[model samples]
Target chain A: MSSINSSGEPAAVRVVGGWASPFVNRVVVALKLKGVVHEMLQETVGKKSELLLRSNPVHKKIPVLLHHGKPIAESLIIVEYIDEVWASNGAPAILPRDPHGRAVERFWAQYIDDKIPPGIRVLRGSVAQDKDKAAGEMSTALQHLEEAFVECSQGKQYFGGDNIGYLDIALGSFLGWIKAVEKIAGVELLNEAKVPNLAAWADRFCAHPAVVDVVPDADRLVEFTVQHAALLRAVNVPK
Target chain B: MSSINSSGEPAAVRVVGGWASPFVNRVVVALKLKGVVHEMLQETVGKKSELLLRSNPVHKKIPVLLHHGKPIAESLIIVEYIDEVWASNGAPAILPRDPHGRAVERFWAQYIDDKIPPGIRVLRGSVAQDKDKAAGEMSTALQHLEEAFVECSQGKQYFGGDNIGYLDIALGSFLGWIKAVEKIAGVELLNEAKVPNLAAWADRFCAHPAVVDVVPDADRLVEFTVQHAALLRAVNVPK
Candidate 1:
């Protein structure tokens, strides 16, 4: 392998993604957390790139991490792959070292996956009333997560204990979309009053060096969401 | 494993689950594959045991494997935990040896998890037409999975090559559920003609020692589904 590049990318490693996708952001934060420099290939939204299709033939979704031309797909799956491949490269483990600890982190990560996406789908629903209902549901979810963070963090700054980790990346990657949802729906989420601790944690997570740069711009995500929804309506693609 | 029980379980390991949950079967098969004899605690449907609630407070779901009094939840995640904890005990790996191989297997496992559950949900729908629609979708999914088997199995007997691996357990756990769905919906799934290879694989998978006993009886599962649906309607429980 060649030397690391200025962008902190490792030679021969590449990520196929879209700029506004939180799923793609997951890969970026993972690479950055590992201090690895990898080339990024931005694919257009709603249109699959030949590289992405070839890389992830099964799902044909983005956030495919290619190492030495062999591709791995699924955002969290790619993050776990990165952790394994680079475990010996002096990077801290993305998952916890102990099996039970790892299992705990994985459980929370899966919880985030299960909870967040459905709320986002409702946020993207056609009716403003539905968005409000979704926002309320997401608020309750955040309160539970605040309790979870307290249990998992052990008074540390982050879920990985003073650093970003699997669960942090799992939830934090949605910072931009969360923002866009609040703006478009005009409803508060990650409710500071109800989930004050988690709301604070969200701030620290987004401001962390690993996440600050890679997260999609909130305004851009808002515009993209609005345009994409209109385009979906125009084309009448089945949801 | 306390000299290995005739039932094939490990000591100090307990599986809190239901008789008919495909998710629970995944744990049983994985444990049996490793020749571990874990205790079983069967929880009634529509009821939560104190142990299950305490072990998995967040989701309050079943299939929690308690090892040495510590709990791990989620079926596949528990499987991975089992693989890691028992890695040095001479059992073949449930996941692959290499990271890329592991990633590939993980991808397919995620695909199976994504594709199977929704079909089951639709199978439980109030209307027969919705079940038919779901069966059609699932049949198409099986066709794709058949293609995946060709790519993954490489003429071997199973997805993990010589034995069942992550993807195998992921989909294989649902064999009985597929049967129940077929019986209840009155339509073919895992369409033998369309996905002949996967169809054959299912027969061999069900007959395997690790799976044969653990999979819930098909007739029992159908009965459970009908009863559970009726119970929900009686109680006016939210879907």
Candidate 2:
């Protein structure tokens, strides 16, 4: 785990997020990594607060970071905001310094953001979600990420090298969801045999101090998935 | 116009792009704004180049920027890359200087990136595209952008305020396709009467020298769309 550089002002930073959300976890863990003390405003699913709606008028989604008076929505964007606001607050840098390195981070973060949970949603999703295609995409994306791990990690501890950086926080936040999905799907995405490095990386990432509390417990997620699937089955009558 | 601080060497910059792509237009225009001359390696729709396949193996898509032999894929990410590498090169900044302002730029640029063409795609799309939902979303999103234009522009000419910034390049690149889709669908998405400010902004944005050569001609796009639609109609027979 990277040591905290400077203790940020706790009162100044706040996150409107749900406890179970991997998206929300990205913002939260990023803040913690920066040593920024923040308050979490728990948001319930299916109901958006005035703060969220105003903060993100377009999507009205959770994980809106309210710094001082302004609201920044979207998890990855919010994490980038945290990195910039505290660029020098001295906790290890979230983004790399060089332009190319930064762009590479953005690319992979985007890849994870766009592909995932959507990629794994099929395990818990209704019949309409297309399990075959989602499974195929997940399989391919995992292989790519496995190769990316070899390249980005460079035999270091994390995507950020010796410490956690942007891609780490980006994909690390989803570890619980991935685990739950794997359990539900009866598949090994980050398999020890197939993606040994990624599987090992997931273990190291989850054990990090910055991550432990932010990411939901995999077992809890599994329970939630089962219940959610049951509820969906009840609600979704055959067309 | 933001004067170029340095004439970045043309030899170092090469773009793998297709002529008719709005995504490609964004990267091209951003480089132009930076006063960086570049070579365009044209790519056909059906065939993927060895260069492209090598550079962006995952999706194998175009609009990959090759700088000093390194590859950067995805248009918005490439534009951000351009902004970062040439940050001091005297181009009007694509992203803003302050963290909050930069976040705002990223938020809206993403809003534009995520919404558009997808929002408007229904107009030029096949049967599966939900016209009503898309049209409704477009109507709402345009209103949001219209309002955002007022806020971001602050009575100035562009989203970047006085000079074209990230959001301007992100959205402006699509004007050609927007016009073509309008011509095909007989709809006014950027309606002057409805969104006077955005409508006016679009006209002004297209006239910018950086944009003129890059964005494909609206009439040409219209011709392409007509041909493409006819081809699709012929191929997809009561599947």
Among all windows of 10 consecutive residues in model 1 chain A, the one with the lowest summed lDDT is A230-239
lDDT of 1 by residue, A1-239 (tens): 13456676455888888777788999999998898878888886567789888888777777888898888988989999989988988778889888998998888888878777777766765333477678887877777778878988899888888778898999888877877778877888877787777788888998888888888766877777777886634432111
Number of the top-ranking candidate, with DockQ as the measure: 1
Name the DockQ score for candidate 2.
0.79
The residue ranges of model 1 lying beyond 4 angstroms of the native Cα positions read A1-11, A124-129, A226-229, A232-239, B1-11, B124-129, B226-229, B232-239
lDDT of 2 by residue, B45-140 (tens): 556789999999876787899997899988889999999999898778888888888788788888877777675556676455877677677767
Candidate 1 per-residue lDDT, tens place, B9-106, comes to 55488898876778888998999999887788888767778988999888788789999888999998999999999888877889988898899888
Supply the global lDDT for candidate 1. Answer: 0.81
Q: What TM-score does the predicted chain A of each candidate obtain versus native chain A? A: 0.88, 0.88
